[model samples]
Target: MAGRRALKAVLIDLSGTLHIEDTAVPGAQDALNRLRQASVAVKFVTNTTKESKQNLLERLQHLNFNLHEKEIFTSLSAARSLLEQKQLRPLLLVEDSALEDFNGIDTLEPNSVVVGLAPDHFNYQTLNRAFRLILDGAPLIAIHKARYYKQKDGLALGPGPFVTGLEYATDCKATVVGKPEKSFFTQALTDVGCSPSEAVMIGDDARDDVGGAQNAGMLGILVKTGKYREGDENKINPPPHLTCDSFPDAVEHILQNLL
Candidate 1:
């Protein structure tokens, strides 16, 4: 394949791409500052569904990340949009604060359902109830399809399996609202007023970021900082347009090549 072309906008992962364990990676902030100075459009895309949009913005601000809420896109936001478009309220199988910003009605009606990450609230009983609701014709929606997320300690089960189990028991398909889905990428591009070909996605996860971008008709760049390991490049079904050591390096490459 040809090398990834220049981009009018850059979509970046938040956690490992910008900061690790609350610490901003070396040159990460500088790179973002440079992008701003050069007037390069940028968006932060994250799969984290544990926090509300306001809370996420506040947290990132507390971490000294100079970003606006509009430039951030989360799986939770996607899921919320999906439910609202359907005019269906969900039982909300998520954290108490997850539905705080959502506009949908909350009810136990047969048309209502659940969506979100499952950690503390995930138990056999919760799964059973979710299953029952799905069997009753309630739709299941997943924020992101990630099976696990990297933690400081180790890998832990994420929202994917819980959603999968419910799908299995209820025999209902779930609408995934996160990356690798065209809706999420298209929405982000639309927010910036850029075409799919005018944007580039950079992240540590090849499948979620790189592969997703490629599938969305955007350029994809992979960074070997977070979950990506050595020898994983060969495994990418469609190789990324470019690969770098970290977010800073990736930003530098964008500056050098695109600007």
Candidate 2:
């Protein structure tokens, strides 16, 4: 406590940290306002693939979040960047809402299978097509592998199970481009001009958000909001530096300890 460095920036998770489904967490808007007032650099990072970047931004705005398009980073965005960098034609297995992110990109004779959380796109025929392609030596690129997420009704399955299934059947390791992967957090930190040690990550998922950030050399604060189970934080090996019930609470910790 006596030797902690002053935190310079924050990476905030979306779906579970700020909102649950289409609704904003109570007081989350104010919490973000406070963070901005403190002059801490913030970047909203998410693993959701159910919508395009525009759709995600619009949704956040609808929920009264103070954010800009440049501040929002999603797994879909990372996937697109990877695809373009490698010049690989992707057989995108993502939700219809997310397809726009890859629009106008050459997908002919797809050699890469990019998987996101799209329940509607997981039918036997569709999955079979993806399976066949993978079997034929196409690389499997998982935008995210989140096991489950909290929904309005209850917890629901995420894309991790599906990604694991494909991995098992194909015997090929997937190229993960989302949370729980150090590269994602590092990339965000780099984009915001902050060193990993100078920032903190706040989110609900113990494995992805908390564990991922910690692994990437940043402090992690686990919030007990969406998708957070009672003992979720305890499940991770290197525990989060702090745990709070909501973003507002997490912000309070940051203000006191870091600023």
Top candidate (TM-score): 2
Error of 1 at 73 (Å): 1.6
- Model 1 TM-score relative to the real fold: 0.92
Point out the worst 10-residue segment of candidate 1 by lDDT.
Answer: 101-110
**Candidate 2 lDDT, 1-259, residue by residue in tens:** 4565678889999998999888898999999999999878999889989998899999999998888999988888889999999999998889899999999789999999999998988788888899999999999999989998787888888999889999998898999999989999988877778788888999999999999999998899999999998999899988889988999999998988788
**Cα lDDT computed for each candidate against the true fold:** 0.78, 0.90
lDDT of 2 at 228: 90
Best by lDDT: 2
lDDT of 1 by residue, 1-259 (tens): 2454556798988876777666776778777887777766889888877777787778778877789998888888787777778878677777766666575455646476656775767888877777887888878888877767667787778788888888888877898888778888988878688788888898887888888888899878888876777875666777888988998788888788775
Instruction: Score residue 211 of candidate 2 by CA lDDT.
Output: 95
